[model samples]
Target: MSNDDINARRREQVELNMLTVAAVAGWYIDTYLDKKSCRDSALSGAAYVNELLIGHLERFRQVCRMERPIFMKLCNVIRSKNLLCDTRDITLEEQLIMFLFTIGHNAVNRQVQERFQHSGETISRHFNGVLQAILSLSTQYIRDPSINVPIEIANDTRFYPFFKDCIGAIDGTHIPVFVESHKQAPYRNRHGLLSQNIMAACTFDLKFIHIQAGWEGSASDAIVLRAAEKDGFKVPRGKYYLVDAGYGNTPNYIAPYRGVRYHLREFARGSIGPQDAKELFNLRHSSLRNAIERVFGVIKNRFPILKNTSSHSFDTVTDEDINEPDDDYNTDERRREGNRMREAIANAMCDEYSIHTRRLRDRHGH
Candidate 1:
């Protein structure tokens, strides 16, 4: 073998060896990726459904914020309405679970993706799909106030006739929000936090009758209420809604007298009872209107997402089955008669004020 021939043969051998190594490495990398993709798909498919079934019932309720029966009923409703259909990899139940879990926990898309072992895109897509489905059911779930008074209000003598025509309480709450710089000015409330002013009306039973959201935080409550009115927020000619002093005292809306101790806390803390007719009216008004505040409390407690707003733009509507009133509320003339009855009761209460105070003191062991 000549020196030149030997050198060429050795170089060719080295080239062949390098080519073989490269081919093997390529095949290994492709196989690893394929395996990873399949594993992820499998995890995503089973994570929500399997966990919901095999885990504790309380765990399911904790994640979805409803009992198992209620959750299943909601799923059936969505299915029957044709609001959501199963995809190749994700079922309707899984999609609903993911949606509720995300909202109930105020989780971001990435967090949901990790929990379900799905891609970020998949998480985003299904979350939006379920949200739209829920929105479609709003009309059916959010009902109109009945013509009769709720038992909670009717049973309370202080609120009965005074608030008989009052369908519900209306208020504007600041819900924290996130927006771009250009939009932040409008969204920033008086406290200088980015928020959206949401106007909601709830009955004495803590059921929402109307919800108007997406208003700028800087907007006043009255402005939002007026906007809602234009957008089909109607009050029957004889009925009214209780509102705070932020709203005007129109015939359709009743507001507490300004410069009065209207909060229930003040009355509970041994504050003086109504000193005059206006004060008496306000005291009764406050007592009835506080139901709306309690409704807000219940909702925020049930859905923590309201406390900590999510970046994703979504609206929430909570509807629990409530019994309807058996009969129509008192008529306008009867309500006026109720007003006279209230005045007499107030006088009697005033006459027995010392005894009531003594009882209060005795109860407190003071």
Candidate 2:
């Protein structure tokens, strides 16, 4: 159909659906808007959505550098599916919304093609733009400008109560992604599916401070931690991230020992042996570490698409479903092939981290 015809139909559709859209927009504002400062309910909400959506789209273009054709392709799918735009005719506002929706959904070329009947190249173009937007937004949102601690935390918490400076909580999460070829093994998880090992950090307030997506699942949590430590991430000095058993105890990072409950969990469980006092220390570390769990929960909550399997052309999510080989490889050929496949597949993953001291050093400006 001609673009004009599509625009005419979309106008009618928007008119019909406007009330519901406004209601949803209201909810969006209520959930995300700053309540104390935003005095005008209706205007403030609308402005917030507009700024966020526009900023998302603009940022996407900067990061992805997508071409027009690809951008159009992605927009078509988002509009057709009623994702954000809800109309075929793309206004600047609708386009912005589409970009935000695409990033939050992690929708890629093939998925867009399948859902919107657009070509792969178009989706690719648009995908880059959306990716760029995500990168920019993530960087923008993942920082804490005020290095100082807030007053409430100083009184309420024992750790860093005086300075209100807890560096952050760290954790690794698996994101389902697809891969091509036998190289997918490394990304495969214990459940026998392909997945990306993503590592992230959040402030004491449960705000996401740093996110490193695109890691292979085969790598240990320690590995992810080590990698991030090298990345010059803003992990403050004299403060430590709360970590689980996956990481090793270091000056900057603290992890609970294996087989012991953290803090109160351990108190109910048993006293520490003299030989295991250090072990008990580790357990106490975990009690503080659990905060990352809630941060991850909130991230997933904000972006429901993170919970949905990636249905991109790369089928990164599909590879996450691959079955692990039944037996461990004893033969040279089997071992070689397995390791080769793991390395090859690992590169395809977005990233990996291991509990390497060198990597940690690099990340910490050593």
Candidate 3:
């Protein structure tokens, strides 16, 4: 072998050595990446499990806004319905708790991630999954209103007999929303905030009977109602709902007389009772109609997401319905008769009270 053969052999050896070094480096980098990924996954899973186990039952309720039993029941329902299944990394309970935490507190994804010790992506994925699961159970949770008046409401003299024909009360409230620039004008309400006109109806028990949301804030209550009617808002031939002045007194819908004191607070000051026929009618109407307001208050309180405008797509329909009544009754006539009866009763009560007061005064000799 001469000088040329020797040089060629040396070059081949150097090339083989470099290739071997490169192969070893690649294998080390791949192993390090795989190990890091596994460790991260394990830590995330452990963190979520530890957080859930760290708190007492009351603490769970305080954070999740539901009793542990109710939470467990809901979890069982989800599992039974196959709405959500347990995964290797996150269980069904963790997904639900995280989602409830976000809704109950109106927390953002980042907040939920930090609380659960997970990545933003993981938090978002489970949040959306739980939301879809809840929506799927809407039909099961929402009930159809019965024709008979609920015993709880019927027993109350302030509501019964007078509200016998009233299946529920309907009203529109503004919920803050976000919209594109071109669409913002339509959603800007009287308060000059972008919002959605959410019209809802609720029974005496404060359970929602119907909801028509996603309407523009600028839309009038009457217009939205008309749209609802057009879209098959069922009102039995005669049963009606108590509504505010923003609605009209149709054959099946009763609105308080305009220019009359309506809200309960308005009658709280200086007056022992209603002053006139309109006032009497309004007093009764407001008392029954206030159920819907209370329902809204409870819902907003329980789920802060509805209280403020969050960065969510407003196009999604979040309307819910439960306990819808069947068939309509003679609403207009019933309302008129009920008003007269209510007025007569009020006067008689006031007169009786006055007589008792005079007797007491004579006894006291003041």
Superposition TM-score, candidate 1 onto the true structure? 0.75
What tens-digit string does per-residue lDDT give for candidate 3 at 259-315? Answer: 878888889977667766567668877877888888999888988888888766675
Candidate that would win on lDDT: 1
Q: On residues 115-191, what C-alpha lDDT tens digit does candidate 2 reach at each position?
A: 43334444454445445544444554568534566343455433333224446678888876667657798888777
lDDT tens readout by residue for model 1, 1-366:
999999999999999999999999887766543323533555554666777867899998888887888888988999998999989778898888888888788888767767787766677788888988988898899988986877876787666655677788998898787676776787889988878888899887888999877787798887777666766778886777888998756666777767877777776777676666567677777877888888888777777778776676523332222222223333476545544544554555444555666799999999
Predicted structure 2, TM vs. truth: 0.52
Candidate 3: where is the Cα deviation over 4 Å?
1-54, 316-366
Best model number under TM-score: 1
Winner on lDDT between 1 and 3 is 1
In angstroms, give how far residue 352 of model 1 lies from its true place: 12
Candidate 2: regions farther than 4 A off: 1-89, 99-124, 144-153, 157-165, 263-287, 313-366
Candidate 3 steric clashes:
12
